[model samples]
Structures are given as structure tokens and as C-alpha cells.
Target: MAKLRLFVDRLSQPSRAIIIFCLANGLDAEENLVDLGKGEHRKPEYKAINPMGQVPAVDDDGFYLFESHAILRYLASAYPNVKEHWYPVDVKKRAQIECILDWHHTNLRRGSAGLVMNRVIAPALGHPLDPKAASECEALVKASLDTINTLWLNEDGSFLKGSSEPSIADLSLACEVTQLQFLGEETKAKILSPYPKVRNWLDAVEKATSPHFESAHEKLRTLAAIFEQRRESQSSEQPAAQSDL
Candidate 1:
């Protein structure tokens, strides 16, 4: 068997997501934590692996891959006997789950990225997000959640593929939504509250991806630590006026 290496950034939702999937499936991937804040990802060494220098990259033997969801699907497909719930066996059932994953990348991920960049990163760097941009981002996230709750996650069906257990789609969505906490307390509550079925699904995701998947508290703490360092660095880099003695 070839050695598996994961080039990840703990603070990245997608990166943490890959971590969960690998651990859930019982594979011990060698993790090389890439620190993005300090510009470590932009270096030539890491860039050779992923030209875009994005986190959540996987290197299996000499083959390199990016995009968190793609990596996850590849893992599940390669290890068919590991966990059936990771990826459904039936063709139609698998397609059904993929529909949700597509919806997540298009809607949920875009909206949540806006919230995270504007609310978390901008502030730490001493710039505030424009009111209109923030408002639009918030509305989009809420609307995406609403659609997930009412359309796909109807009360009649239990999971995305109508399975009692979670699928890869749930894992992908959970990874992105979990990062919303970095936006703020009020934002976190609002995004999580309105949808009953979504909340239930979230609980199922956490339960299904057990011990290896971080507890909610652990995720938040990790983000807080990252942002705190960001704030400290921003504060230090600010220019101070000098007075001649």
C-alpha cells in the first residue's frame, strides 16, 4: 500500500472535512498542516503539489489531488468495503446524494465564504465589510438553508439518499456549515436555528462521523485560536508614529 499524505490547514472547513472523512473510514492519512495565514501555502514547495496552493490537498503515491469533495469521493470509491454509508452502492442512490453535494458547492459554500471573509477575516485585518455585501451574504446563507430544509430534507424523508444513515453529501455540507461559527455568535445561532430538519441532520452527521470527527466545542475552539492569532498579527503590523527623543 502506498503512503497517503494530506496537506491541510486546520482552520479551513474543507481541510477539516477531509480529516473527518479519513478518520471516519479508519484510514490514518499522514497530515501536513499547511498554515495559510503566514503565507506558507504560497511557497514553491507546497505549490508544486497544488498549483493553486489551496488547502485540503491529497498526495497518494505521486498522484496529487485537490478540492475537498473530490478527494472524499475518491477515498470512498477506492475503499468500497470500508463504509457503505460513505458512498451508496446503487447508481441512482449515489446520484441522488451527489445532487445535494452540487447544491452545496454552488449555494452553501459561496454564501458561507462571503460571511467568513467579511465577518472574520476583514475585521481581523482592520477593514470592515460593506453593509450591502454583508447583508447579501447573510440572506443567501439563510435562503440556502431554507431550501435544504424544505426541499431536500423534507420531514417525510430521513436523509439525502433516503437512507437512515448519512452520506458523503451530509459530510460536505456539514464541513461548510460548521465554519459559520467563525462569523460570530449571533450569526451562528441564526444560521443554525430556523431549520428543524437541517438541525436534525446536523446532529446525525456529527453522530455518524464520531470520535474522529471533532466535537462542536473542539471545532469552535480551533477557529477561535486561528482568528486570535490573526488579530494579534494584524495589530502588530499596524504602523506606530515615532517621536524624536
Candidate 2:
């Protein structure tokens, strides 16, 4: 069988999730970098692979697939070696996971990705920061976190939906929360500290995935440092500019 080809950028939460899943499961796969920073994902070559031109797309032989959740489900079913815990065969269990995945896009993704993009990524990409949008997104993020803490997670298990082991849904949401690492420590804590259960589940997911989780997030951490430095520099300049005024 031909190895699956994953086109991904680690900076993307979904992309990192896919990469971590493959590594954790020991799947036979090849990673192809789709550098979103350089607009590589927008090129004609990448568009051919994924008409939507998104990171975290996969090519299983000639079968092309986009959308991280779909890719995860496909990989779990198509690969014989994948552990059932990731996507259980029991109908109810799988449905529970699916419920989380479906809720994730509108609730979690918007808030998490929106906050990151508005606060850090947008300015770097030449869009000025929008404080109003950022505030709205942050509110959504906190609401989503509250939901996760009170609803999705339970004392019966460490993973999402109270599963004993981590599932693709767990990896998906964990990576989304990981994006908060790029925010300044004070801001990150402000957003996350209210939900201790959410934080614990995140740690559990990382531990379950192990070294692969750290490896996949390496670039995100590097960029987080750079973003922090940039924020500090801007802050120092702001004081001087105010003094001049």
C-alpha cells in the first residue's frame, strides 16, 4: 500500500492535529509542507491537490481529502493498524465523538482561531489589529471553554466525552486550545485559568499523544516567542510615542 501524503502546516491547529494523529498511530505516511506563511497553499500545484486550498489535506494514493475531521475518520477506518480507541466501533461511542467534532467548528474553532488571528496573525499578515473583533472572539472562547469544562468532560474519564483514551476529537480540540500558547502568558492564563478541567484534559491529550504532540507544536512555540517579542517592542514604542504627544 502506498503511504498517505499529508499536506500540512504546523502553525495550523488542524494541520498539527493530523500530523500528531499519524505519528501517534504509527501510520505509514509522508508529510509535505504547505507553508501558509509563504502563500504556498494558494499556488496552482496545491490547489490541484485540494481545490479548497487548505492545509491538513491528505492524499491516500490518488484519493484526495480535505477537512481535518474527515481525514481523521478516514484514516481510522482505512488503516487496519489504527487502535479502536481513537474511533471506536461501537455506534454510540463513535456518535459521541462525532457530536464533539461537529460542535467544534462553530463553537471552538471560531473563538480559538479568531482570537489568534485577530490578536497576532492578522497584524503580521498586514491587517491591523481589530480590538473589537478580538474581544468578541475572546468571549466566545471563554464560553466554549465553560461548555467543555461543564459538559463534554467528566470525572469518569480524562478525554473528551469521558472516554478512557484520547480520540481524534480530543486531539482536534486540544490543538485548537494549544493555539492560545501564542498569546502572551498573562492573556493566555486569563483565558484558560477559569476552566481547570479544560486545562487538565489538554494535558491528558498531550500525554496520550506523547513526544509527537510536542514535535508537531515545535514551530508554534517558536513563533509564539517571536510574537511575544514583537508585542513587547510595540509596547515600549507606544510609551515613547505617548510621551512625544
Candidate 3:
């Protein structure tokens, strides 16, 4: 197997998941910064890799892939040495896991992404996201959290698909949860306090994959600087205090 290449912005939850998954699984991959903070990802060079300008893009030999869920699957499937059995070979188990992961991207991650983008990145850059949009973001975030609460209310400790070991679902969800932590301590505490099992599961994930959140703080610094620049630029074009979406 050729050394893999991962183009990513560490601050993005999906990107972080892929980065951590690869490291945890002992897959050799090169990391390149596609700094979203600086809008560098929009550059043509990077766009050729991921036209949408998203991170967590991977290159194996000559093959390339985008959309982080696929990347995770590739890492787990193409290289079985990772010892990530939670992915499941059994059709039924794999189907269940895939369902959770798919739901996460559209429902769970979507809501959290709005909160992170609106509260942290938007104002910090220059855009100053609409106050209404910001409020809506909070509502959606609460909804997402409630769903998490329901998911783990079961007597079983399984975070997803009755598996104790971490899987793609855990990887993807943890990345989003980390964003809430970065958004504000208050929001994180509230959401996590209600879901003790989820919290424990996330901790287990970090422990299982040594250095699970490696370079997380470092990632914040890089993202912050970019947000500031965007905020300044956007604030110039329109009032930063724009109300509602």
C-alpha cells in the first residue's frame, strides 16, 4: 500500500475524525493543511483535489476521495490491519452502523455544523452571520442534542449498533461533539451532562486510539486566525449586526 495523503483542516469535525481514525489505526498518511480559516481551500490547487473545498480529502497512490464518511470507510476497509472490527463484516450489523452514520451526517452533524459556523466562525471572520440564523442554529443544536439523549437512553451501554469498540459512527459523532466544546464550555457541558454514556464512549474512543484528539488545540489557533480575517472582511461589506437570516 502506498503512503496515503490527507488534505484537511483540523478544525472541521469530519476532518478531525478522519485524521484521528487514520492515526489510531496505524495507517501511514501525509497531512497537508487546507486552511479553511484563510479560505485557502478555495484555491485552484486544492480545488482540483476537492472541488467543494472541503477537508478530509484523501489520496491513496493515485486514487483520491472526498466526503469524510467515505474516507473513513476506505481506511477501515482497504486496510484491514487497523483492527477496527466495530465496522462489522456481518451484513446486519454493518447496515445498522451505516444507518446511524448516514443519519448523523444529515441530521446530527448538519445541526452542529450550523452552530459552529454561525457562532464561532462567522463573526470571527467578517460575515457576522444573521442574528436570526444564529438563534435558529441554537434551536437546531438543542434538537440534535435531544436526539443524542434519546439514542443513549437504552439500558445497553452501546453508543451505536451494540458495539463496545469504537466504529465510524463514534468517530463522526465525536468530531461534532468536539465542535460544541470549542464553541463554548457552557453549551458543551449542558449537552454532554445529559448523555453520560456518550461522554464515556467518547473518552473510550480517545483512549482506544492513542492521541485521538492530537493537535486539537493547535487546530483551534489556526482556525481562529482565519475567522478573524473573514470577519473583518465581511463586516466591511455589511453591518456586522445584521438581524435574522
Candidate 4:
């Protein structure tokens, strides 16, 4: 069988999840960088691979797949040698993970993307901030965190779904929360402080997937730094603009 070809932009949360999963499992695959910043994913050649022109698509031999969650499941199933905890065979466990993945799309993932785009991407794109949209997204994120804290995580379980080990659900959700890194430290802390369980779960996921998780997130770290610098520059200019007014 041919090795999988993963098309990804590391700065993307889902892309980081896929990359970290593959690396953690020692999967037979090669990373094909799809530079989202350069609009590489939108190019005609790339569009041929995925009509949506999204990063984190994969090509296994001639078969192509999109959507980060679907890609994660396919990889886990195709490579049986991967750890069972990732996509478990046990019916109840598997169902639990599947349920979490499905809920994630509409809840955590959606909110995280909206928040990151509005708070960080909009400024960088020279677009004015939309306070209403940002507030809505923040509410969604907070609600999702509340669900994870009160429902998904068990007091005795180290991961979501009460699994003894971390699963793709954990990875997916952790990546979403990590998007908060784009905000300033104070803002990030204020948003996350109420969810102690979510924070503990994130720490566990980071520990389990680490080194690879950290490696895959290098792009996000750099992007966060860039956002911070831009915010600082904007802040410095605000006083001058006010003085002139």
C-alpha cells in the first residue's frame, strides 16, 4: 500500500490534530505543506484535490478524503497498528468518541474558528473588528467549555469519554481550546479560568500527545507572536490617534 499524503497547514487547529495523531502513531505518511497563508490551498491544482480548497486533506494512493475529523477516523481505521485508544473497537467507547467528534463540529470547533478569525485574522486582514460577532463566538466557546467540564470529562478518567487514554476527541477539542493562545495573556486567562476541568483535560492531552503536539503547533505559536506584536503596535498608535482627535 502506498503511504498516505497529508496536505496540511500547521497553523490550523484541525491540521495540527491530524499531524499530531500521525506523528504519535508513527503512521506511514508524508506531510505535504498546504500554505494557507499564501493561498496555496485555493490554487486550482490544490482545488482539484479538494473542491472546498481546505487544508488537512489526504491522499492515500488514489483515494482522497477531506474534513479533518473524517481524515482522522480513516487514518485510525486504515492503520490497525495504531493504538486502540485512538479509535477504539469497543462498541460503547467507539460510539462515545464518535459522538464527541460530531458534537465538536457545531460547538467547539465552530466557536473556536469564529473567535480566532474575528479576534486575530480580521485585524491582520485589515478588516474592522465586529464586536457583536466576537461576543457571540466567545459565548459559544464558553458554553462548549462548560459542557466539556461538566459532562464529557469524568472525575476519575484521564481523558474525555472516561477513557484511560486520550482519543482523537481529546486531540480535536484540545486544538480548539488552544486557539485562545491568539488572544492576549490576560484575555486568555480570563476566558479560560472558569473551566478548571477543561484546563486539566487539556494538560493531560498535551502530555499524552506531546513533543509531536508541540512540534505540530510551531506554526500556531509563531502566528500568536505575530498577532501579539500587531496588537501592541495598534495599541501604541491608538493614543496618538486620540491625541490628534
User: lDDT winner among the candidates?
Assistant: 2
What TM-score number comes out for model 1?
A: 0.85
The digit string of per-residue lDDT tens for model 2 on 1-245 reads 44699999999999999999999999988989999999999999999999998898999988999999999999999999999999999999899989999999998999998888887789678788776887799899999999999999865899888888999999999999999987866678778898999989988998999999999999998999888887777779786541211
Residue 143, model 1: lDDT of 91
> What alpha-carbon RMSD in Å does predicted model 2 have with respect to the real structure?
2.7
List the candidate 1 regions with Cα displacement exceeding 4 Å: 123-128, 155-158, 215-220, 225-245
How high is the lDDT of residue 52 in model 4?
Answer: 98
Tell me the tens digit of each residue's lDDT in model 3 across 124-185: 56777565665686677776666666664243655554566778877788778777755445
- Tens-digit lDDT track for model 1 on 89-134? 8988888888888888778888888877765667555678565676
Candidate 3 global CA lDDT score: 0.73
Ranking by lDDT: 2, 4, 1, 3
Best by TM-score: 2
Better of 2 and 4 by lDDT: 2
Off by over 4 Å in 3: 152-155, 221-245
Each model's C-alpha lDDT? 0.77, 0.90, 0.73, 0.85
- Root-mean-square deviation (CA) per prediction: 6.2, 2.7, 4.8, 2.9
Stretches of model 4 off by over 4 angstroms after superposition: 240-245
- Residue 5 deviation, candidate 1, in Å? 0.5
Candidate scoring better on TM-score of 1 and 3 = 1
Worst 10 residues of 3 by lDDT: 152-161
Per-residue alpha-carbon lDDT of candidate 4 for residues 74-160, written as tens digits (9 for 90 to 100): 888898778889999989889989999999999998888888787668856678767678779989999999999989985578899
